[model samples]
Target: MEFFYFLLIGAISGWLAGQLWKGSGFGLIGNIVAGIIGGIFGGWLASKLGIGGGGLLWQIVIAAGGAWILLFIISLFKK
Candidate 1:
């Protein structure tokens, strides 16, 4: 289902973001939340920025990129 894909992409995006940033993850639930939020932001930003990519993989990539941005901000606050 579409919803399942959204969650899946979001989870993977969060995981990938965690991996991108060292010591930046709140665990599964945190990741999901971050990922979902990032996915929406990323998708919108990508469209606005005219970044071109296709398919589920592209979606995950963009979402993860956005997640990384958010996680970085959170890390800044935590420090």
Candidate 2:
């Protein structure tokens, strides 16, 4: 299903973002949440900026970028 693919991409993106961002993700659930939200943000950003996010790899890349940014913003507020 489309939802499953989205979740899969989100999980991978979140995990990768957490790993790259010094492991700040809450846990599996947190990562999933972050990734899913990040995917939305990324898709929105891509659309607004006229960037292509058509393929699975592109979606992952965009989601990861968005997740990293989201983590960075959260850390800033938490500190």
Candidate 3:
């Protein structure tokens, strides 16, 4: 279903962001939360940047990028 696909994307995005960020990986639930939120942020950012009509792959890329940014901000506050 579409919902499952969304969740799958979020999980993948979160996991990918975590791996790429290094020492900033949140656990499963956290990853899901971050990914979902990041997806929203990414979508907003993409729209603001005039990037639209992206497919699933583009969505994942944007989501991962957003997740990475989110983690980076959190890391800053933690320091």
The reply for model 2, stretches above 4 Å from the true place, is none
- Which window of 10 residues has the lowest lDDT sum in candidate 1? 19-28
Pairs in clash, predicted candidate 3: none
Better of 1 and 2 by lDDT: 1
- Judged by lDDT, which candidate is best? 1
- Candidate 3 RMSD computed on C-alpha atoms after optimal superposition onto the true structure: 1.5
What tens digits encode model 3's per-residue C-alpha lDDT throughout 6-27? 8888888988888887855777
Tell me how far candidate 2 lies from the true structure as C-alpha RMSD in angstroms: 1.3
Which stretches in model 1 have alpha-carbon errors above 4 Å? Answer: none
Please give the CA lDDT of all the candidate structures: 0.87, 0.84, 0.83
What TM-score, over all chains together, does every model reach?
0.88, 0.88, 0.86
lDDT of 1 by residue, 1-79 (tens): 9999899999999988877777558787787788989999899899999996889899999999888888878879988
RMSD of each: 1.4, 1.3, 1.5
Per-residue accuracy of model 2 over 51-78 as CA lDDT, tens digit each: 9757888899999888888888887998
Residue 24 lDDT in candidate 1: 56
